[model samples]
Target chain A: MIPVCKEIRKEILKISNASGHGHIPTCFSIVEIMYAVYSNMKHYPKNPLWEERDVFLLSKGHAALGHYCTLAKLGYFDIKRVYSFGSFMSDFGCHADRFKVPGIEASTGSLGHGIGLAVGMALAFKLKKTDRRVFVVIGDGESNEGTIWEAVMVATNVGLDNLTIIYDNNMSHGRGLQIRNPAERFRAFSCEVVEVDGHDIDALGPEIAKRGNKVRVVVANTVKGYGCKTFVQDQYAWHRRSPNDSELEMLLRELDEETI
Target chain B: MDLSLHDERIVMILGDVSVYLFKDFNDKYPNRLFNMGICENTLISVVAGLSSQGLVPFVHTIAPFVTERSFEQIKLDMCYNKFGGNIVSCGASFDYAWDGATHHCYTDLAILRLLPGIEVIQPGSYKELDVLLRSQYDNGNTTYFRLSDHPHEIDLPVQFGKGAVIKDIGAEITVMTAGPLLGNVLEACRDLPVNLIYFHTIKPIDRELVARYSRTKILVIHDAFGLYEAICEVPNLRVSYHGLSDEFCGWYGAVHDIRRKLGLDPKSLKEFIKNTIEKTGS
Candidate 1:
């Protein structure tokens, strides 16, 4: 993992531990995918509200911290607000806040809905003959939702190649069981699947650069926590756990005391 | 009442007979229309997509196919989204009695009414329906208007958005009828002096109207689902509801046979209303 990515995951763990409100395992699973997307965004933090800006919807909305941390790191919002997450009336908390947050495209609390909405945005862009693309990151567990498959079928039927779908296939889900391989499942949905080590930004950067008209699925294989040694291999517990003094010391030491 | 003048932005999603019923509108406004053959889920989703793009969609399909078949799509894509569009579901209230269970939609109202922000309408007559079609297009939100396959001409000066309160208000009892069942209620009311009121709209239910008129006597009659659904709202009102009970409708039959089996016969319905009023008064 890059030094910066490692630093951010520790920060997320700190805030989530303090607030006791984060989908950490899922959030940690998609760090590189988030990094890949926000970096390649044509109209990111500069023009967040630009109608023609490429849209990135976190369809598996539970893993919202990945997107939020990436957005803040990319200078979309202030990093200090991350500590206020999950507080009373705090817009920056758990699920992506569409109304208050600048980068979020839509409010998605329910599973299986974001992909459908993303497909609509993509189709509309296509009809307008625009160069903008829509990227959606979904969870392998969320793939079991019927609406996701419904949307997958529709995207394929309509030949929506411009939309890119990434699956954070960290192998584990809410019930603490690893899911079926996302690459195989997504391939069954007729999407062009790309398997990549989610922690490797080099692989992600090259793959994201190759955009096509058909929907692309990037199956990001990742450990829930890549940077902190305590979480690197422990998928279930490390996904969401408070850092005690020792763990915090280890995490902060890994980041070399960088506040950012 | 002329739909062509105001429905300029209306995107008609066609299914079953809707393609034939609104063929002219579809052809003239091809950009604002689409045909999803036999795929009601996609039909609703497509219209929902169009509405998101700022095109006001008026999705059309037979009631059974649109409501029963693609219920999840309607619940999620349209009602949940609270997108502005018109769901003009035709063949409402067993109007497709000949087509059987796959085509019977007695539970559409019962199901759709559960969705918040959805305004429901069941115009008593064709003239009333035409006015509602125009008003709904202008007034945005998710709306489901029940239309009959059998069209008949009936003249009334009163607009149908507001419930039609019969003038002269003679009898002590008020029979609240909705959709095609209003025709049956009106027919039953002719020989009797019982007063008549029609519920043209269902959601954001005219509670004030229902409360005021429900003082003396109340009897709600309509297609099985529509009537039961409306009655469930005013449970405390001294009202008698007449419709099909919650059960699987087995097979297709003539409209009259279905009505008779469901005890929606004019004679039985009128008698039920009269008896309820008499019992309430005594």
Candidate 2:
């Protein structure tokens, strides 16, 4: 693991341990994808609302801790403030609120929502005749919502080449609504498709950068918990469970020992 | 949209509802108008995305599908995210009454007004829609413009959040209505011993004007659900609703059939108002 993304995973662990909230396993699944998107997308951490900047939305909002950590590491805000995640009156909540956070484009908690916002934004760029693009990260589980496919269909039909959707294929949907071949489905919907390993930033970054002829989709195959063995092996148990002191230490040790 | 000429940010996204109506729109502003298919949810979501980029978008379609089916999209993407746009819905309430109950839309204004950071307008006239749409479209909040095919010819003052009092005679009874139903409502209360009030805006429900008639027994008469519920928001007012029973409007022919059946026609309204005046001994 790269040091920054590892550091993000550690930060997510520490915050969720301290805050007693968050879908930590889900957050871990998208660490590298989140890092890859931020590192590759054209955005200013200091000037978040800069008119000419490209927009990124974390559509599967349960992984917001990962998104907040990604933005903080990218210098959007101080990492120290994120320890208050899910606390009362805290800007950083379980789901990202665009008004509260600097880089968050839209407040999303409900599945199938943020992708639609991303579609609208991509269409806006097309209408405005701007080179600015939109990036959105949706979860495998969130695909069960019909609105996700609805958005993808619109993005494809409108030929929004500027919109790049990153599907965090963490198989969280395997327990429920299964999308067996997401890439084929996306291709059937007429999107430019690329399959990538979610944890490998080297593989993810280029896909994030590649703008295609139609709506581009990067279906990133990822583990539900990439860094820690305990969460990965027993994902459903730790899906929404925060760690105690001992578990946090064990997870930290497991993360430090991770070689991938 | 005349705003389309000067303000290049105004993009109209339709849900395959009124595509032919905007043939001129497509011709005049080629790239600005998009018939964004039959997906209502996607249209609102896309409009939010467009608004996030400082672009003003108008997502128009049939009232129920766009407003009811895509209610979550509007609540989460547009209102909650504070992405400003214009949501112009045609076929208000029973405007598509011939298309049956699924095509009917009366809960739009009522349900939409419940969402925070939204402006709900049921414009009764073309002048009202034109004036109010121009006035409020760029204000940077989710503003819903419910348009009707059966617009009244009444030329009332058009404002974004204020109410228009047509008749404020100091009678003990007051009749409040909104949107195109004002034509029937006005004729119903024309020679009655009561005051009549009309509104284009619903959310910031003109609390002061509504409160002004608090001393009177307010009769909320309309063709739909929202105006009655909105009037009930004002405190200490003896308000009673005279529209929309708690069952589906099962039968359908035209908007007129539904209106007459629901007792929203001028004759029924007139008789109801006269009876209210008699019952209360006003």
Candidate 3:
């Protein structure tokens, strides 16, 4: 089977060239997180509307470009369709459009929202005695939103072990510098928190496996722009900046030379 | 009616449907309806979650509790997400007539109208409410219907989405009202020389009708804070926002008494229009 993360990132970079879109760094940060969810989960491909499929919410919606590409790479839709991202009458906008996309569980972008929805879903599954799992990814900066913590309290208090939340600790956001402390807070709210290197796919597998029927948090420490050379190590500005031609060339070269 | 159809219903998250609406239903089908408490934020979020799973949920609560209390939830969960469901918000402007300021819900139309791709309806009567309820179910859409605790009783077509003219146009200025104020305007029409225009939906404000029918000035009769305040984009036309000011209403009294004290009596309405015409000389 094709490695989901690598394939998705490649397609994402291709779409970035067409729209010259920003948020490349944010998209890059969550690539593996999206990969981990899509790859391991028992999802309904033929019928995305199937009720029993595991629910995945991209709470840190700026990372949706990664989700779009991941959905494409996983054979959810044709990869060429992503070329129309952020275009006129395009279903694939910067944020995940739940109505148009077959697999996205929620439409998101406004932070601090998805976790609450996920919590509700988890509660529903628990009460109904269903095996459906709910996964939500939140940006480190997105943790600042009060609603996220509100849901965390509700989820933990309700003992919703069916939920797993991934925090993309890329250390950046709209107003800049996401607070680097969700461990103590998430723990205070009674959630099991696991800090790991976000780029390490191997580290992710074990951490996810370790979460046995407990509401868990995977704090993925990743650089904002992880893959390209010039943009790879950069922060803040690269979070949503459209690449210049020179930057694009450098990024392509960096990808071409890399051996994953 | 088949109990399953009513049981297979959805909540109007950003409005107030009484606890009785479900409590009465629960008496018949105990497991059917859910009263999500007063947690407006969680309530709307849960409604959206239910909608995602293809569960038809009818969320009901007061306007301030539903809209202001859980506005972000409504925006992110229901509107921006584009989830097709019904949000029936009762007690539009004067629903809180005596409950005072915090109880009044006049700002819903102004704020909800700003969101893209949301269908808003203010049903002027019981017949209109039935029509709206049917439309939301028949055509799966993200819709909001504003209702009054005491809506006007009008014998009209079941078709919604259009405003109804309640009075003839023999006067200069039009006194536009919704909810309880419709009856108030009609009562005052007995003594005054002003025409009445009843606006059903406030979000997509019928500019053409307002501009056509109202020649001199327009006086909006509401019980809560009027559109000129921070909540809604007040119309730019020659309009006056009449409602309880920024003060909260905790006084326990009849709604009519409260209306009279707030200068919302039919006599006051006539005088307000007369003063406007005299001052403008249009």
Candidate 4:
């Protein structure tokens, strides 16, 4: 793992431990993907509303803790402020709200919603005749929703070349509606499809940079918990569990590959 | 259509409804109008995205499909996110009466008004549709326009959230109704000694007007469920709804057919109003 991505995972563990609220396994899966997208997206942390900034939406909003940590790492806000996650009156909730946080282009929590918003935004940029693009991350598990395909079809039909969808194929769908062949399905929808090892920053950067002739989808094959074997081995158990003090220490050590 | 001409940022996404009505607008602005299949949920989400990017979006479809099926998209994507857009729906109540009970839509206004920041407008005529669309389209709040195929020819004053008083008779019974049914309601109340109130805007519902006439027993007559629920929001009133039974309107033919069957037609409504006046001892 890249130092920053590792640090983000560590921060996720710490924040979830402190706050008693975390979609820990889900957040762990997307750390590298989020980092790559943010690093590649044209956003000014200081001026998140910069007229020319490209937009990013987390469609699988359960992974909000990962999104906040990534934004903080990217200088959107102090990383310390995220400790207040899920608290009353704190801007940061388990699900990110766009109005409450900088760099959150659209507030999303429901499955299959963010992709449609991203499509509309991409279509908007096309209507405006601007170079601004929209990138949204959707979980493979969330693909169970029929609206997901509806949005993808709409995006492809409208020729949203400026839109890039990152499908976190973390196999959280292993138990339920598995998107066994996401790349083929996207290609069938007329999207430019690319498969990549989600945990590798180098592999993701290039794919995230490419805008296709139609809607582009990066099928990031990821484990639900990438850095720590404890989480990776029993992901469903840890999917939404915030680590206790002892568990946090062990997870932190495991995140460092000390006892893996 | 004028909205797109006046504002370059306006975009329309349709769920395969009202395509021909917007023919000229699409011709003028090809890139701005998208007939995005019959995906009501996706259309709404797309509209929210357009709104988020400072582009005004209008998603049009049938009433039940857009407002009922995609309720969450409206609640979260549009209202909760504060990404404003215009949701223009056709087939008000039983406008698709020939299409049967599956196509009837009366819950749209009632359910939509429950969302915090949504502006629900049931345009009774072409004038209300034009005026309200011009005023509320770019206000950066999700606005729902419920349009009927059969618009009543009454061109009364229209506003975004204010209700209009047609007759301020000091009669004990106040006949309150909204949208296209106002014409039938008006006709029904003409020979009767009762006050009449009409509303084009349902949400942020004309509270002041409803409150002022709170002393009088308000008879909410409409082809839908929302106008009564909205007026009742003013609190503690002898208000009752005379629309939309607890079952699907199983019988259907046309808007007028359904209206006549439901006693919303002029003659039936007049009889009902007369009975109400007589019952109230006015």
Candidate 5:
């Protein structure tokens, strides 16, 4: 799982370097969370739209490079296809588009939309009496949207225990204001909040697996740029900036040396 | 009711409005109905999600909130993603006139028409609303149904993508419109020697009918903005438009009073049509 995360990060960097456009740090921060969820979740890559498959939505749609790489690694498509991330011929855009991509559950780029989409899917699953669960990965910056809280209230009120939310608490917001105490806020919404180290798969795997009668929120505390040394502990500038030539070489070298 | 009864996958979602109107609907299918409070953005995105799951979701709210407040969601989630859902909006134009500009929607048709593959329908009466709703649901496309309080007793059968000739006496001038403004246009042209055409579906604009009446002068009297430009695609048609102008109505009054102030009332529309006919010498 750790090696897969490293590989996904490498692929994301390659796509960003080729396209000269992507949310690199944002995608890097969520690689482990994506790896943990994809490794443990029930999904058939060949049959992407299988009815009984558990749903995964990247609410923070800017981190689409990470999602594309993860889906490619899971054998949903060829990894080579993702290299055309920003090109007109490519199905993958900077933001995830569901119609073009097979494994993407929903088209998301605008903030505060994915939570409601997940809630609706979760409600449908409950109505159909299916045991399938829905996992949505949302950014902490995206949490500032009021619609997210509206979905949270409804999910808790409806007792959608089959729905799980993984908040990428990278402590970096777009407008330079960090969301203070997201776990307490989730608790206020009556969600069973579970705090975990976002980069550590051992801590994230078990927390994501836990399900009960209430909506569960796993707050994964992580750094803005997880693996790369240039922007690892940096703030908002690295959110979407592409790496220069030397920076790209340095990132690839760092990934090679890091013992997962 | 017939559509929902036949297809159990059809669900209705509300945005803290239209509960009284949907009481009977909720009583019949309680599980299929959901009230998502006042969150219009969530209402649209949730409907998109439900549509993705192969369920036909019909979302209802006031016009401005559903179409304007959540415009991005409707564009990206529903239209861009090509998800099929029905957005049924009430309080169109100035129906909720006393509630001020916040509740009224005058540009929804123009905004939604720009979205690819979305069918925009504005029913002039209860009969048209029922027929258009059922037709769009059966087609299972991304459609927007504009509902209003005006009820016109017309004999024309409501078709999905076609226009109805309300009073076609082959006159020199043709007046086209949709929604509640159809009633005003009909009353305004009752004594005039002109032809009247009402459109239940706005987006497609019934191009054939527009081309048929293109040799003569045409006047479009509508409550919403941009209908004239949308329907005037025919080159030969000498078109003059009378609808809500670019100015915002920030005051409060009855819908008719507001329409009169905006030069859309029956009296103003009649005078405008007479002036147009006299100027064209048709």
Candidate 6:
């Protein structure tokens, strides 16, 4: 799992570097969470739109590089398609487009929309009497949106036990805004809240699998730019900027030396 | 009736604004209906989700809240993602006149028409509304039905993407209008030598019909914004527009008074049409 995370991070960096634009820090923060989901969730890569498949939606859609790389690695499409990240007339835009890309459940880039979309899907699954789970990964800053709380209330009121929300609590947003306590905020909306180390696969895997009769929110605490040497500690500088040549070389060197 | 009887996949979601209007629907299918409490933005996204799962979801609310407040959700989650849902918005233009500018939606058509692949409908009569609702339900696309409370008595069959000729007397001047304002337009052009045309489907706008009237003088009157402007986009047509300007109305009064003030009443429209005919020398 660690090696796969490393490879996904490498692919994300490559795409961002090549495009010269992306939300690298945001993508880096949620790499492990996404990796855990793709590895553990029941999905068919060949038949991306299979009805009985578990769905994953990136609510914080600007961090689309992470999802695109993960879907490519999962054999949903050719890995070479990631090279057309920001090219003109390319399917892979900076944001996730469900119509263009296979394995994308919903097209999300605007914040606070994914949770409500997932709730609707969960309601559909419940109505259809299916056991398919809907997983949504949202950014902490994205949680500041009122639509998220609206979805939270609906999810709780409807008792969507099949729905799970994994919040990437990266602690920093654009313009250096910090979320004080994301788990407590989610718990106020009447959901089973669990805190876990976002980078720890051993801890995250079990937490994500735990489900009960109510909606569950797993707040995964993480850092912005998890693996990069210069960006790991910096709060907001690397949120949208791509690395230059020297910085890319340094990031690659740091990733090589880090023990998995 | 066909929507509730035949199609079991149809689910109605409300934004706490249309419960009284849908009481009979609620009584029949209580389990299928959901009142999502005044959160317009969340209502749109949830409908998109339901649509994604192959169920036809219809959302009802006031015009401005659904179109303007939740504009991003309608654009991204519904239309951009190609999820099919029906947005049934009541209170077209200043129908909620005394409720002030917050409730009055003058630009719902304009904002929704900008999005690609979304069918916008404005039914002028209860008969047109009935046919349009069933047709849009069967068609299954991202459609916006701008509903008005003022139902006019018309005898035209409701067809999607086709303009209905309410009164065609072989005149050289054509007057096109939509929504409940069709009643006022009909009264205004009753004595004038002009053909009356009505449009319920605004987005897949019947461009062919508009072009067919290019040789004649065209006068378009709408209650809401941008339908006339969109029709005028048909190249090289001699068109004159009569509707609300691209400005907010801070005046609060009855619907009739507001219409008179905006020069949208029947008498005002009659004067405008007479002037237009004389100017065009048709």
Per-model TM-score of chain B: 0.86, 0.98, 0.80, 0.97, 0.95, 0.95
The residue-by-residue lDDT of candidate 1 on A31-134, one tens digit each, is 87888887786765866887668888888887777677888888888878878787898878677767677787766666767777777666666655678788
TM for every model, in the order presented, reads 0.84, 0.97, 0.78, 0.98, 0.96, 0.95
**lDDT winner between candidates 4 and 6:** 4
Could you tell me the C-alpha RMSD of candidate 6 in Å? Answer: 2.0
Cα misplacement distance, residue A70 of candidate 6 (Å): 1.7
Off by over 4 Å in 6: A174-177
Q: Which ten residues in a row have the lowest lDDT in candidate 1 chain A?
A: A251-260
User: What is candidate 2's lDDT per residue for B1-282, written digit by digit as tens?
Assistant: 578889988888989878888898899998888887898988999898889888989988899999999999899888888897999999998999989999999899999999999999999999998899888999999999999999999988887889999998899999888889999999988999999999989887899999999998998887777777787887788999889989999987988888999999899989988999999997
Q: How many clashes show up in model 2?
A: 2
Per-model interface RMSD values are: 3.2, 0.9, 2.5, 0.6, 1.1, 0.7
lDDT agreement with native, every candidate: 0.70, 0.90, 0.70, 0.90, 0.86, 0.86
Residue-level error in angstroms, candidate 3, position B207: 8.5
In DockQ terms, which candidate is top? Answer: 4
Q: How would you class the docking of model 4? A: high
Interface RMSD of 4: 0.6
lDDT by residue (B1-282, candidate 3, tens digit) is: 243555444323322246655555567654445554445677677667767665565567777777777777878897777555667776666566667667777677667766776676777678777766776653545677777777666565444545566676566666676544666667766555666677665555556666665354666776654222321233456667776666655565666777777778878866766677677664
lDDT over C-alpha atoms for residue B127 of model 1: 78
**Per-residue CA lDDT of candidate 2, range A112-191, in tens?**
99899999888878877889989999999999999999999888888999999999999999999799999999999999
In the range B29-90, model 1's lDDT, one tens digit per residue, is 65545554555665666566556656676768788777777677677667666555777787
Across residues A198-240, which tens digit of lDDT does each residue of candidate 6 receive?
Answer: 9988889888887778899999988878877667766467768
Instruction: State which docking tier applies to candidate 5.
Output: medium
